[model samples]
Target: MRDTGYSLRNAGCSLLPVRWGLFAVAILILAAPVAASGPTNPPNPTTVILVVGAPGQDEFGRVFAESARLWLQACEKGHAQSIAIG
Candidate 1:
């Protein structure tokens, strides 16, 4: 009598499910190439320059206000000088 135990049942291997999982992962992995091909260069970026005065509590406001007043006085005088020069 032959004892065809459970060893015979496990001898043959099926690659269908493994192949499907690999195919799904392969499809997911291949999208990176398409993404890489699209955008070779990016658009130009915008820039802005801001002059923000300090808040009152930090003593920045007082110094800034004094500097601004001096600048205004100089500008006013500069305008008069320009007119005289012309």
Candidate 2:
């Protein structure tokens, strides 16, 4: 082969800048999701699901019912939707 002064070592050195540029682009692309995932307030009101387990005793049942009522009141004040399940 003619000595054209080109070898594998020099070939890799010449491509160093291109490799670094590709790496930088890849890093930016990977970070895009993380940047876009930042917190933002929703446009609509929130929804709350209030679940009251089985109150085995009469006293427990009254307390559970009272708790549910309080939650419903708070939901109304906040303009949120509340679903209660027993």
Candidate 3:
């Protein structure tokens, strides 16, 4: 029961657990607005277009077809949504 001035049990302690608890509560209250302040508008979905044309010097159209297939795969994944071809 010695007065070390830092114990929560000491009524005269300047740094009590209650004081620390209040400090933490005050910090959380002040930070609540910041934590809740995200983008008011959510992200808009994206659109992508894949245009496949004649590969001038290619013996076959494999390159163009492969590129288009990759684009389709991207759309299938969550990375892309609406897609069109021209």
TM of each candidate vs. truth: 0.29, 0.49, 0.49
Off by over 4 Å in 3: 1-11, 27-44, 57-60
Candidate 3 lDDT, 1-86, residue by residue in tens = 68666654455655567789999999999999988997586665777777777777675478787878888887778566655554
Question: How accurate locally, in lDDT, is each candidate?
Answer: 0.59, 0.91, 0.74
Whole-model lDDT for model 3 versus the true structure? 0.74
Best by TM-score: 3
Whichever of 1 and 3 has more TM-score, that candidate is 3
- Report the candidate with higher TM-score, 1 versus 2: 2
Model 2 / residue 68 / CA error / Å: 0.2
With a 3 Å backbone cut-off (N, CA, C), the pairs that clash in candidate 1 are none
Stretches of model 1 off by over 4 angstroms after superposition:
1-52, 80-86
Which of candidates 1 and 2 is the stronger one according to lDDT? 2
Candidates, ranked, lDDT: 2, 3, 1
Error of 3 at 75 (Å): 2.1
The numbered model that scores best in lDDT is 2
Candidate 1's TM-score: 0.29
